[model samples]
Target: MVKYFSNDVDIRTTWDLVVSAFWQRYPNPFSGHVLTEDVVFREVTADQRLLSRRLLTKTNRMPRWAEFLFPANLSRSVYIVEDSIVNLVTKSLTTYTWNLNHTTLMSVKERCVFQESEGRPSLTRLRREAWISSGVYGFSRPIQEFGLARFKSNQVKAMKGLEFALSNLQGLRLTVAERRHGVSPASKTQ
Candidate 1:
């Protein structure tokens, strides 16, 4: 069994700042399960596009229903691999992430796109798509259903985490254009 999830939101910020925030979002209060993040690869293309690969560690996030399937001694930390590309010319950023660990029980694949809002320049349109499945388990189909249900619940909390990061960005008194430059107005003075 396979399940899907989606989200649409308007972030009152430019793509640059949104992309920057994406790289810095894991440490927020709403995402306490996220333990560490590391950039495994990054490069700027000749056309000024940015490509990056990152690995993230999430701790103590296994769902209660699925804990018994996995061994008690199995490390609580799960690793996720993310790859993203920023199209500078089009003012958009797209990303894909999937579990690098715990592949046997379940796998969740997610995609996110940030684009300059056509109707509102000050806002960026964010879209998310996710697919989940459970394979190789004794009760694979039922496990997938259980995993999907939990994933949908987690998605809300995760979006709130991103929103929290945006609120943090907004708290620093950054102007619309200031966000594009990757700095708040007050930070420029020092």
Candidate 2:
């Protein structure tokens, strides 16, 4: 069985900021489960589009009831591959990600698109979609359902991480501007 999920949200930030935040979103408090990320490839196209591929390692703890089904040597970490395209002309970023391990039990593929909001120029629209499937015959239905639920929970944390990164980026810019003006950070409080 296969299950699908989709969601759309508008973030009160410009598309450029959103794109910048995405590149720095890791190591945030909300994403402790994400262990590491490495850029495997990146290139700028003739059309001024940026393409990138990254590999990520994340913790994947199984539920207590499901623990007995897997082999003892199975690693607690899962590998994920993400591919992204950034179109400077259109002010859009699109990414596709999928897990590289544990496919026999469950597989999840996700795609996200970030674009400038049509109604509000200062806002960015994020559209996310996911597909989950399992090959286990009798357990496919339950496994797919569990995958969908977990995906939803992880997405909440992902958004929080993004927000944290955006705030940090803005704060850094503010500090740089203040320093250039010869204004101390302490002076702002006074």
For every model shown, what is its TM-score relative to the native structure? 0.82, 0.97
lDDT of 1 by residue, 141-187 (tens): 77777767767767777878877777777665457667888877779
Give the Cα lDDT of each candidate. Answer: 0.81, 0.95
Candidate 2 has a TM-score of: 0.97
For model 2, residues 14-84, the per-residue Cα lDDT tens digits are 99999999999999999989999999999999999999999999999887767787787889899999999
After superposition, the stretches of candidate 1 with alpha carbons farther than 4 Å from their true spots are: 174-190
Which of the numbered candidates is closest to the native, going by highest TM-score?
2
Pairs in clash, predicted candidate 2: none
Query: Which segments of model 2 are wrong by more than 4 Å?
Result: none
Candidate RMSDs in order: 4.8, 1.0
